[model samples]
Target: MSDPVRPGAVRAATLTRQPAFWVVAALLAAGAVRIAQITGRFLGVYPLATVTAMLLFALLAVPFWLFLSELDFLEREPASLRILAFAWGGLVATSVSIPGSNSLENLIAKLGSPNLAADWGAALAGPTVEEIAKTLGVVAIVLIARPQVNSVLDGVVYGALVGLGFQIVEDVVFAVGAVAQAGQGDQIQPVITTFLVRGFLAGVWSHTLFGALAGAGIGYLVVNPDRTRAHRLAMAGLALFGAWASHVLWNSPLFREGLGDGAVALLAVLVFKGLPPLLLILYLVRRAHDSEAAYYVAKLADLRDPVLITDGELRVLGSGTRRAAARRHAAARAGRRGRAAVRRLQRAQARLAVELSRDADPDLRHSAEVQRQRTALTELGHPEAVEGDPSWRHTVSTVGTTVVAVAVLWAALSFLGNG
Candidate 1:
């Protein structure tokens, strides 16, 4: 969605013009070049298979991208930085980590028994090298765009994007490798099977989760610059440690030692291994989002400007479910146009709220954007009905749609697995 405020004064910051933006842009371009170099041989051999694999994984990534984007609703990050994060993960992290991880594995094999290295090499080497490589994407963004990441949630958004980019490319590589392994030149089956296991079964809990954990830590350091250096370092360390430990756990052979004995057992093992970290990251994300929302609510309330944002609007916008319901209510009262206008109004209010929430500043009322959004609310016809009890069915519809999407994907994966 476009920014709602006037272009004259409340113009969106020209992030592309920033030096840091250009630096990240250059890195992303370099990363893309490196990726092309790495994949050229495979692309030359199996152009069709590689393209199909890339498309499938990219399709699977849509819902996740939307979810992470929604998490940063109040203050969306610039698209350039978001794309940069994704490029870093898919290109730079993947390109560098492949050789680095192999070197680590090779060293481990030389130092230890081949059997031990075979079982544990990825567990050790991957966490040490891959986690850092992936996180460096977030760190680089932080270094370049210091003001962009204002909260832990911002870090999670960037981190998840990076991980997502990495996951898509890695999944494509795995799928291509699977086709090669099948050896019958049956492209579809191997690609489908790979997608079933990696994309469906474990995609959510893999690199994306690890990157978010690490990004939160990097965010903590940037967000709380006033905190003690030791405290910030601890936070950063914890973030990296959490990410490494999670990567180690995922890469370890402990689960594969015996759990593949039965189909049910294997499914159980997948759930057992993936669910905990998924739940943990979910919890952290929720906590960060809640803190962010609360901060915005307090800031909006402090403004005490009914013209711009009222207590009722603040209450409704504070919760995700409620926000959805308000839009539904607006649609019911008017039509699609009403819904669109209200959405624009809400976006303007949210932008203003976010601007005001930055460090408890009170003079944000003078911000040009703040004035524009206030004018917008009046012209858009602020509906008093939005503050009323929302239709509970609206919340149900939103959640039901998500549940149905997952079910359809699950069934599709199952069909592929069986065939």
Candidate 2:
């Protein structure tokens, strides 16, 4: 998955000795302190609205956190580093961008006229300042923990978390701002409206998605040592530009103004601005995850131990879809415990692959764990080595899922149209 830091590669400077570690640490601390002050003031001024905003965004963060953390299941990024990336976005990037975007917007007004600033300042300045700042959160991870970022998907996960952090905090600020503007006396209607519009409607294509696009570039830059440095840098630059352009378009009213009034037109504008990047990021995630799963599953195949991972299981292990189908098959065969056992076996097999990659099994540590999981499967009469559902079943399920997804999309769009 990450040939750049393969076993026996030249070791980077250790964390204690790296000056970049201290620099990042100092910046994070300062950002946290500043954010805390601002949050304190916001609460003091509008306790109900502030609390409502925080609760809504905090709940929203859970699914994003779980999904991103699990993207690279074969070699999941460590929790601490993921949290660090989020903090960098929530605390550091948001803190910097508040003043930075404002300053840049003022400069634009001075140079291009107030009318220009009013029309385009947020589109230009916010993305310009915030994207760079959020991108640096990924950079900070690479600088501080180079070994942890050995996959493009790693960058995507970290970037998504950072963007998620920024998004939640920025949205809270905006929710409060909306409250202040409404002069609603700390009522929660604005907070709820903000939650639906920002956290529900636009959340999927907002900062988190942008961060992931940029993070994929950083991951490529770090992991793909086979390419020329110039070529790698160019790809990374292109990814970042794509992220910025997507953000600018999402923020800009230039296109929305032409879409005219009414919810139908507004829905069209939202889809036009958001859908391309959503598709792009989905494609990237699938591509990266499949490549990673293949690499690790191959490692498991080398051992040729059915107890650890059977041939049937090997086929399923390399694909997330098959893995899920296998679990469903187990549930039908046995029950709830059977489903759980199959899941455990799959996870154990994946972990064994990770350990096998390093040849660090002098004592058969990870192998023993896989065997234990296998034994549990045996007890439950649901061995981890069953052929998955037939191609026809998969085709039916795929079509069913697509139909459901389309139905949901139509429902959401109709709701927005009615709004």
Candidate 3:
């Protein structure tokens, strides 16, 4: 729905430019300082290799981080606050969660019960505290800027980014520590190998996916007010269970044997345990996308400008890639104004979908629907001409999903076999 309290376009435009400019400038300055430090390093430090490992870990993390950051649902909040929340998740949340869990395990062990430590680490500390701490970013976002979280996926994306941040920092620390502890004059190859395996292979299951699953539960609770507290609690339980199970399986002694045995066991576990939940989540996302598209299509039916959007365009918008392509086409033809209009229409449709999913008072929902329709109509200008058939979206989504599934399966197999 149209936010009656939407920021003035002029102010938003000015603020938008500042983020890009500052981010670039900051990155450049940091890069320069890092290069100088590395060049000045002494013989004891393999500065070049250390820097490379850090950079590689960061590079490995960028795709996941960018994926989470690109989510439009988070744009409502002040950019600085959002960045701070992510940084907090990466640094403070991770720092505390890791050492805190370790301390708990040590306490359990010191109590002359090592088995208890292992059990608690797997069942409680790993899932309960870590998942909550990782997902605190979503909580902060919701409490500080409630409007930013309009859908379950928004929470998932934000939480996943926070997790990715934590994973990257943790991996870099491990790599650097490995080299430092290897003693003076030792080869850096082992540290490099550790970086590759941890940063690339195992990183997917680290904080990112755990936070995503937990965030999904939290998102369901925040957006679905009609759900009873008991139901919300159950959802939380299921999410934590999933996170813990995944972590436990990944860290299980079964993998201590070699990659082949580990791969077989892990594959069986993932198929039975992991794939179903992820599939269900994907189904929910598709339903939400379709509902959003349908609402906007219906709302704009009465517009005098019949060319604002077509059934074909609505179909295209039902999938992520196609929607992106459509926006790019519009921007290329009609400039920033057209792109902004498309974004507004998309956001209005998304908000309308979220409202539809809720059990809000009938009058409130109806009013929201009306507002969304009006906003959509106002923003949808002349439709830009684009090439390719409408069936392209289905093809794209199918190919993209298949590729991701295969890649994930391969990674799982590799980790199970190698670990």
Best-matching candidate per TM-score: 2
In order of appearance, the predictions have TM-scores of: 0.85, 0.91, 0.64
Off by over 4 Å in 2: 1-17, 260-262, 360-363, 385-419
Candidates ranked by TM-score, best first?
Answer: 2, 1, 3
Q: Candidate 1 clashing pairs?
A: none
Name the runs in model 3 displaced over 4 angstroms: 1-50, 71-82, 115-124, 180-187, 258-284, 291-304, 324-387, 390-419
Model 1 poorest ten-residue lDDT run: 1-10
For candidate 2, the lDDT comes to 0.85
Tens digits of per-residue lDDT, candidate 3, 253-284, equal 44343333655665664454445545655564
Error of 3 at 145 (Å): 0.8
Give the candidate number with the greatest lDDT: 2
- What is the RMSD of candidate 3? 8.9
Q: lDDT per residue, candidate 1, 371-390, as tens digits?
A: 56445444556453254465
Whole-model Cα lDDT of every candidate shown, in order: 0.76, 0.85, 0.56
